[model samples]
Target: MPPMVVLSFLDAPVVTGPARGLIHLARALPPEVRLHVAILRGRGAGPVPPLDEMSDGALTVHEIQERGPYDPSILARAVAIAWRTGARVVQSHSYKPHLIAMAVRAARRVPWVGHHHGWTAENDKVKRYHRIDAWSLPRADRVVAVAQSARDIVVHEGVRPDRVVVIPNAVDARDLSTPMTREEARAKLGIPEGEFVAAVVGRLSHEKGQDLALRALAQARAQGAQVTFALAGDGPDRAMLEALSRELDLGLAVRFLGHQKLVGVVYKACDMLVMPSRSEAMPNALLEAMTLGLPVVATRVGGVPEVADDGEMAWIVEPESVESLARAVVDCVARPEERARRVAQARSRAAERHDPARRAERYLDLYSALGVR
Candidate 1:
């Protein structure tokens, strides 16, 4: 028999979070299962690295040149790729790709499996496309949420609970947990040694609360905390964050490193991982950081609670409050022994929960349980 095929569509190049999770799952599957991804666009409108180019072993990636951001043509092209690849299971990652998969499935009568990555539909641009999600979601054969919080939203929004599978995020930690020293990682990136480095990883956006982190950093510095902040990943909020950094006179104290290829290196070089997201599903960066044994300080919103308990892993602060967040950072920095113990616990938990091989087997079960709708 031919291998069961999975067709994936992602919005970005770096392939973090659900994208990275899916790739990890795909790579862990048996040889009889074939996986191919069709992305709308990649890093920097940059070249879409071939499927084989980025694979660790045998996973294949097929890239498509997107016309523009959220371009309709990309969705249309995805359908063509699905047919060309002889895919048995159509898996769509991003929201646009979900719509595209449903469209293709509707025409071809194929099972459209959606992996929900929780794109913000409240945006003005996405609000214009409200009808699209409302229309496609009900028709899906199966939908997987990266976080239970995401599943709750889909279920509350009227999607069938049975149809939505709550598969929380998982990771291939062994690959990410490189045995590189912090000094070497810092040297590779030219960061000064001995400075207290606080790293926040995510696209710099309002929802991500990168700006909120900067505000908290500013607050802590004003209170006589000697620290430098580095932000990884870039997005629509780049100019705004850069301006905010300067406005706060965070010169040289905060640096935007842009999108990184080795997030493991970023995690290792940091003293702690801070996520001040106003809204999120379970962020993969948070999981990765925990797996790498770094203490975390994140807002208590979305699936963050699912990743870290209030006093476990790292500090969890109330959302949208700079004062509370600053206190949380100070608390973590002051209690180094407690923080180190928490990091050890977090790494242990991450190893057990997100074991790539185990999660991939669950995905296989999901596939077997899903039939044509």
Candidate 2:
């Protein structure tokens, strides 16, 4: 039997949600099922995926460094790589990979699985890609939606509901199960011992709503909440977000930590995780925070509500409401006993619902049903 080929098209190998999920999936795959990963347009900064490390010697990686997004040569190379490797099933992430997989499937008659990680479509480029995905997904043999929200979009866009499956992103529950204590984690990160720290981990982008979090933090501090905020990850909106922070007079109140590779330490160090994303699709930050037993205050958007429980695992707030966001953070900060209780319940839920091992088994089952031997 040929190996399963997973295609991820992104600028780099960062610790984003989709990348992390792929890493976990590769780690948990059975030895009999060899895995090959192809990164279209090559790697970027940040920690590379541990595919080779995790899959032992069963994983083969192929990278095609295209000069730009519209590079025509990548398509040919990707198709050749899949056909040469005898890919039984080509699972694709994002629009570019979907097109590549489509071409490969057309040539080889092999099945293609489209993986949806949700979309922003905020700009023209993303909008065009979303349009492409909308058209391409229905043609895929199977579509793996990372959340119910994504699956709904897939079904709404004309794909058969039976052909689309929802497989929520997985977190390594074992890593979070025995992480460092909050105090120890804070000490390691050089955070003050008594500060009420809130972590917002995601690309610093408008859609991610990091600006909203800054505003909320500013409001909470103005009301004498005695809190500090940390913005993790980098993006084009960093300058704008920094400017907003300055405008809000959040000089020392906010710290911009640029894409920390050790994201686990960031989760552990924070007193609570705040995800004020105006849009989301099963945010790995929220899931990881929940799994690490960190109290979360997240906006009720997209797949967040699907993945987190309101008032049980997380404090769900309205999207883009600075007041509501601030109030939730302040409330979470004030209630330690409640936080601990929620953490216990959230940990149990995360282990049951989002464990990497279970996620891998589900993918393997999906593969079997898809005729991958």
- Number of the top candidate by TM-score? 2
User: Residue-wise lDDT of candidate 2 within 1-373, one digit each (tens)?
Assistant: 4445544443346445665666677777876666677865443433446556644544666767766647878878877887677777787888878888888888878888888888895689889888998999999999999889889988998889999988988887544443578787777767877777899998888889998999899888877788899888999999999999899999878888888777877877787899999888888888888877789999989999888788988899999899999999888888899999988988888889888789988888888898876
> Considering only N, C-alpha and C atoms within 3 Å, which residue pairs clash in candidate 1?
51-61
* lDDT by candidate, in order shown: 0.78, 0.80
List TM-scores for all candidates, in order: 0.90, 0.91
Error of 2 at 303 (Å): 1.2
Q: What TM-score does prediction 1 earn?
A: 0.90
lDDT of 1 by residue, 157-260 (tens): 67899999877778776556657798998887667898888889988778899889999999988877777788989888999999999999989889788988
Q: Give the per-residue Cα lDDT of candidate 1 at 16.
A: 60
